[model samples]
Target chain A: MLPPALSDKQTVPFDDRGLAYGDGLFETVLLRAGAPVLWRYHTDRLAKGCRRLNIPLPCQAALDATWQGDCTAELEVLKLILTRGSGGRGYAQPDEVTPRLLSRRTPFQPSIQRWQQGVTVRLCDLRLSRQPRLAGIKHLNRLENVLARQEWSDAAIAEGLLADSEGRVIEATSMNIFWLQAGQVFTPLVDQCGVAGTLRAGLIDQGVVAQRALLLDRLAEVERLWVANSVQGVWPVTTLLAADGSLLQRWAVSDSDPFQRLAHQLLGFA
Target chain B: MLPPALSDKQTVPFDDRGLAYGDGLFETVLLRAGAPVLWRYHTDRLAKGCRRLNIPLPCQAALDATWQGDCTAELEVLKLILTRGSGGRGYAQPDEVTPRLLSRRTPFQPSIQRWQQGVTVRLCDLRLSRQPRLAGIKHLNRLENVLARQEWSDAAIAEGLLADSEGRVIEATSMNIFWLQAGQVFTPLVDQCGVAGTLRAGLIDQGVVAQRALLLDRLAEVERLWVANSVQGVWPVTTLLAADGSLLQRWAVSDSDPFQRLAHQLLGFA
Candidate 1:
């Protein structure tokens, strides 16, 4: 189910800027019933990333063709990467910009138990660096995320939460985090670090979540917490682990819980 | 010329963590008379980078083979990239580490005029972010360098200088910078940001330069300034430009100047 532009026969060039400098952006989209779910949100985010990175956007028609051609799988995870082509010797941009588009599809596997019973998460010791210029866009400069994810290897721990150098909770390794406090839904403001996930954006647009600068101390006051991404939708967090991997707090999610309701709404999106 | 591993026929896998997350490090060595100019320094830096990034060091035999096989060009730019390899879907590292090595060679063109008469450099508006965990290693997460380099397009300007968010002068876009005042050489400490370059390491080891926290105001008191790297050796900076491209300061270099002596010592290495 790979896109024609990124089939098994295709190969990324050795000098691709994406490989050399991580001068690129990517989007992971969920496809259901042979159709890409939240296609507009993904493309819109990609467009924003291109503008921020100053890389020319690939034609919408070309992207649509690839998506349509590859969306045959009933349930699939589509990954698209856009790099600033290749051939600049150093930091300078190439004189001729030919943005490369690579897409691949894999069978989607739902985490039913995690979505049903919720999952445990731990705090990562590695604090994200502040770079307002590259704060929100899903750029390829993701060493911070990699380091954070590597902090824990326990299969039982679903995700690792990251904070900025200032001790403000930013996000999970690969998802946006939202918490309910006194019936108010709040997510971290990603103005200084962290990616603004597509699902989080959609939730914000729907007036289901508000963005705020979250501190580590404030987590004690959260009634319920959940992490969200485009592919997995949302997962209620049952336990929060401290830096030493010790359980710091716990929560129980009932069927009527707002977090559970939000998860259901996201997962049931067509 | 190209190393067999990185010839035009070679291709980087789409899922390589290096491409996907900038989870890699690279080294560019200068070749003179069919030999690597600073082989030990380059390898040492690569080893340090791998240790910092938690990527397994590529086998010594493989690295030797690539370097030894591609030194045919009398004056060549040898590039070596060591990536975390492929198959980590998200931010996680693959269970089995199979680091990939890519090498390339290009004809070296020395900037003799810039070295002899000095070149003009300007300050960049984009301030580098503080990431102590990633500081000093030449990792592939170089979007900061790209954005800083893109600040100006004038061919007359040889390089652009960068500072950290705290307004501390760091380094040039592609090279490490050093300043001289009253016979003392000082370079910005890269512990907070910027690459610890091979040439800079050599200079520091030789006891010719000292690392210090340099501020923008300190530039006014500098008697002489130069930037150095593996490929270009060293280039004396004749004029410094403000962010608005206006002349900020100027320096004259004589043939017997200490900066010129250091440049000759660096360039004459074989």
Candidate 2:
């Protein structure tokens, strides 16, 4: 679907930095009942990303206007992309910065089965590269995620887990992962890689999740695990598969009380 | 200037993977006298990039047709972007791959003064992240280069030298760098980071340049240094400045025989 601001155009400008060099940041907001869930968190992350990338933040009033004018879909996925705007050939930031704000809405396809019955996830062979500067911020340079997602084509596999080169588990391709062990919940620290997802942040802020460096080898010790993202609230992982598709670990979390409680709380927010 | 294939469009489709996740690769070809300089090298790199990224390579006949139909500009900078095509939301590769080939031509403006008198370069504070899988391919995930280029705004500084996080000198923002020491020419190994530039590859293939891991501390030992790219030819670095704009090293290469000979040889081919 066309972005609300760009509804009149069939495409972004050819010189858009977003297409040229991936010089942009994006936020995926879950829209329920025609209103964005955790919009403040999404905008906060986008603003923080802009501050780090040195791209000028779009005015809040402009964003509010766009939301009020275009947020009409009751059940949809909203994607807001802020690019450094069109510019000449070269890597240098343009002299007159005119940041382009694009908003797109798509029909939401809920992973209901995966969320209820639990889904299987496999470890991706592609290792996430360490870029502390770009880490945690949802910038547009997401080819690594694309590569990881391409590792498997099985419809049964709901997601693929990614790790850094050092064998430290990072996150799922498009979500934050959390493991429950000894009644403590742990999520991978995104300081060196992976996106600091909005739901993950909210959970952390609400004192339900704690960040820690997780090793791939330690997966067997986890009692229960689940993946979380804004669009897909939570999915308890029933199976963990190795890179070669060998079953590494399995958890009976489909009826676990803790898993259900956390998922319900998160889904309620969504 | 609009690409001949897309003169009527103001924007690329919003779903373009290149715009969405930088899921694409690009090649910048130097056009002189209505013909591409180093066309073989550029296409070779683009094809290699496609192979690595798993994006289906555009048919050679299609590429040839585009080149022939679009190479009408005598002096132009030709940019060819090949995206994984428009697709639905998500990181997964689309089921039906329809790669989008975009071509644009801009008037070539050679850095004549920098080429003749040499230019000053600075060590960028931003360190290039090592991602061996993505290294050396001219893919569209170029936020690192953009950040490095944004490190400096001085018009006098022609380029900024980038290094991996381990303090190993990689290359200039948009060009491959070479240093001459004891009559031996050395360029950074692109196995870990940096784009394996077309001109750099040509020189290496001709047994004129050798790849080596260069450290920032060893710059003082070099007799002469220059950066090379397809469009810019070569520019001897007359000064090396630190990230804070402090002069670290200076050289007189405008009259150096070796520098002039190499630059002339490279420029002649361009």
Clash pairs, model 2 backbone: A11-B11, A12-B11
The 10-residue segment of model 1 chain A with minimum total lDDT is A1-10
Instruction: Report the C-alpha lDDT of model 2 over B154-260, residue by residue, as the tens digit.
Output: 88999999989999999999999999877788899999889999988888887888999989899756888898898888888899999999998999865655644
TM-score, each model?
A: 0.95, 0.94
Q: List model 1 lDDT by residue over B150-192, tens digit each.
A: 8888999999999999999999999999998777898999998
Residue A97 of model 2 has an lDDT of: 70
Clash pairs of candidate 1?
Answer: none
- CA deviation > 4 Å runs, candidate 1: A1-8, A70-72, A263-270, B1-8, B70-72, B267-270
Error of 2 at B164 (Å): 0.3
Q: Which ten residues in a row have the lowest lDDT in candidate 2 chain B?
A: B1-10
